[model samples]
Target: MAKFPKNFLWGGATSANQIEGTFLEQGKGWSTADIDKFIPKEQRKSGPADNLVKRADVEFAMHDKKGIYPKRNGIDFYHHYKEDIALLAEAGFKMFRISISWPRIFPNGDDKEPNEEGLRFYDKVFDECRKKKIEPLVTLSHFEMPLNLVLKQNGWLSRKTVDDFVHYADVVFNRYKNKVRYWITFNEINVLEMSGFTSGGILADNIANRKEARYQAAHHQFVASALAVKKCHEIIPNASIGAMIARFESYPKTCNPKDALANVRANQNNLFFSDVQIRGYYPSYIKRFFKDNDIHLKINDGDKKILREGTADFLAFSYYSSMVAISPDATEGEKLTSGNLKLSFQNPYLRSNDWGWQFDPIGLRIALNELYDRYQVPLFVVENGLGAKDKLSKDNRIHDDYRIDYLKQHIEQIGEAYQDGVEIMGYLIWGCIDLVSASSCEMSKRYGIVYVDLDDYGKGTLKRKKKDSYYWYKKVVESNGLIL
Candidate 1:
């Protein structure tokens, strides 16, 4: 096997809310996830509604609670950062992709002054990563917004949220400007529209009207992202700031041109966030889509200038599986929803993960090739992994050959993309440790190479057990490629 670039990043990915679970500890107040206690259902208000059992679920059920579901303490990454980082280091990670909790930093979304305790927590976290000589790629916002800001100011639907986001980003950039080099302004910024308020951590009632609210909220975020990019350069002139999008591999449902056209349109819209961020402007197709739909955005003075000047240095995205989108007239069948997309199981031919994200390793190569052709910027795959249900035998060993198979095939495609002149930056698999799933907020959808014993009901000791994939991944990373 050939070696990857001398400095290529090989790491696992995680988010503050999903892994670091001191939701209200230290100076941290209730974030948007904490405010979810009143949402009444799962999937929240964004792409999919998710009722992640609040603290009340751990004791007395709330009015909108769905029985006694798992409590919000996910995998205890907040308390276990050192142990987990050691595991990641053992896997030979050159870099570690992680995000900071907004509420942890700001406590309140609109706060100009950051909480010293909140900032200090990350000080330790990043310092630990740097101690291990692992580069830290930090995300400013990852689906977590302070609830007070959302309820009081009406969330991202208002332009005020954009300014608040800039302030929030500034707080972290100034503190960790020297420690972290790679910064992603938003995580899956486009999903705020596809899944509606659910993806952005905003409540459904806050949306008021789903369609209009989605477009309006996304408009605010796009501008906010542009401003973040611009401010990042001002603060850390040499920082590599990129926009993170959930890049889906779109496939046509049929050989017919009609199906092909529909598939292309879907990809264009689904992947259009990058067009705006990378190109620093909306694409022609996006303008046409808005005109045809009569969806107008609230663009103010200098917003275009911010986007144009704040274009990202590169593109970092998450790819788990491809979706087969059919045209309106084509013969419709089941949809693939098993792997990471977790939409609906509409495609019948493909197999999927327990959570319904379709499994397609070939899609990774296609996604890489396509992004290179269109954007012509360096690409970094920040998140890609298989989430499954792993069982522990009496001997306490987990035989997770399924996960090894999934990663092996994807690594093969990564090799193909690298050899094909894709200028691939790095590959960070999702949930290096067994953390909560961002979609359903469940532990059953396991993605970690190292397994955690906790379940959806929150039973068992939060033990970290190395699965079979752990040893396999260590070798893969040590070799800089798959050993096969």
Candidate 2:
């Protein structure tokens, strides 16, 4: 039996945009996720690209009338919350992480009043969690920013979006103040550069200056996140607010000095966002980086003060896989893999998933130690899982031993990290139930212990069945990870 702290939170995570299928239902407006077009597996031979320009190029692909918009029908979880929550309770979930879709509350991003129907919907969901004694960890904004915000304000590029996001945060924080104690501001906030359209709603190709636009939008998010943290502390007493990042750990491909230095630089770039959120100020090297890139952020009056005053209570991040960094002059073939919206250089020693995401369980331990050494704050692993093609057996069960092996190895690594003195507050597996993939928008790339009877083309009965990994994970949570 593996051991974890008694208070450790064990649960699953799903964002509203990925699972809640009712995109246009009950006064909900269109989100960036809603406009995402699904590409089939056969056409995805080159794999999912993480560049902002490439993502923006596909923006108009949604206009095709015959295109399958899979996000619009995300396994119909919007209507199946009761059934889903019941299954989670049966699996012994101590916590359940979810995101409140911004467009759902405001209908449009800049609305003065939130939609009553959207607010009531979450009320019932949270009430159900409370009935089952499951703590709800809520993300204020995921990738589903209102499409209206992008069309009207050019997304977070305009500072007005900051105020709009703050308004939305204030409404949800107050509404679910009692129900949700854990709040994450901006999911994977650091991915703004690579995923501007999805992360900040900035259409990369349309912008005259892409670099400046990305950084400025990121600055607005930083300010907005800080403001929300301050507001949450004020409105919801004892609430713990965290800043989330996509933790892309990097290692030098070789022992050469140049390779090691490149790895350090790569890591610094990845750690920049959390540094500002946790430390409450920009790192000194950022000024030189910004100057070298000819990117100047517009910092308004009192923004620095707000940022300094409203630091996050903890750090929450998604660690999928680590990348290898090679020097500019290094002679080696670049083996690129896809995961977490970043193209990673493949590590020779690690095994990779079917999607080309390398599996390095030790990377989780290294990331935990690195983050703890840097921030000295409590950490929550909000997202980590293997997305695979699942097949159901004739017995009406998914014998997904591969998923079980993936999770078990990661859990063992997490246990080792805990023993190494990392203060891990929780672990929430990404996409607890099958949902639409954010990068590829494909439903076939499933990542859930509980299998949903759905297909890539939106065919099937939409029935929920527990995979073999479901019972395996239930025992893990029931024993507080000891059974792992």
RMSD (Cα, Å) for all candidates, in order, is 3.6, 1.7
Off by over 4 Å in 1: 1-3, 35-71, 201-209, 331-349, 482-484
**Alpha-carbon RMSD, candidate 2:** 1.7
Q: How accurate is candidate 1 locally (lDDT)?
A: 0.77
lDDT (10s digit) by residue, model 2, range 164-224: 9999999998898888999999899988877778888886656767878888999999999
Error of 1 at 381 (Å): 1.0
What value of lDDT does candidate 2 attain over all alpha carbons? 0.88
TM-score of 1: 0.91
In terms of lDDT, which candidate is strongest?
Answer: 2
Q: How would you encode candidate 1's per-residue C-alpha lDDT over 176-262 as one tens digit per residue? A: 888988999888877776655445544465333455667777878888888888888889988999988888777777798987998
Off by over 4 Å in 2: 45-63
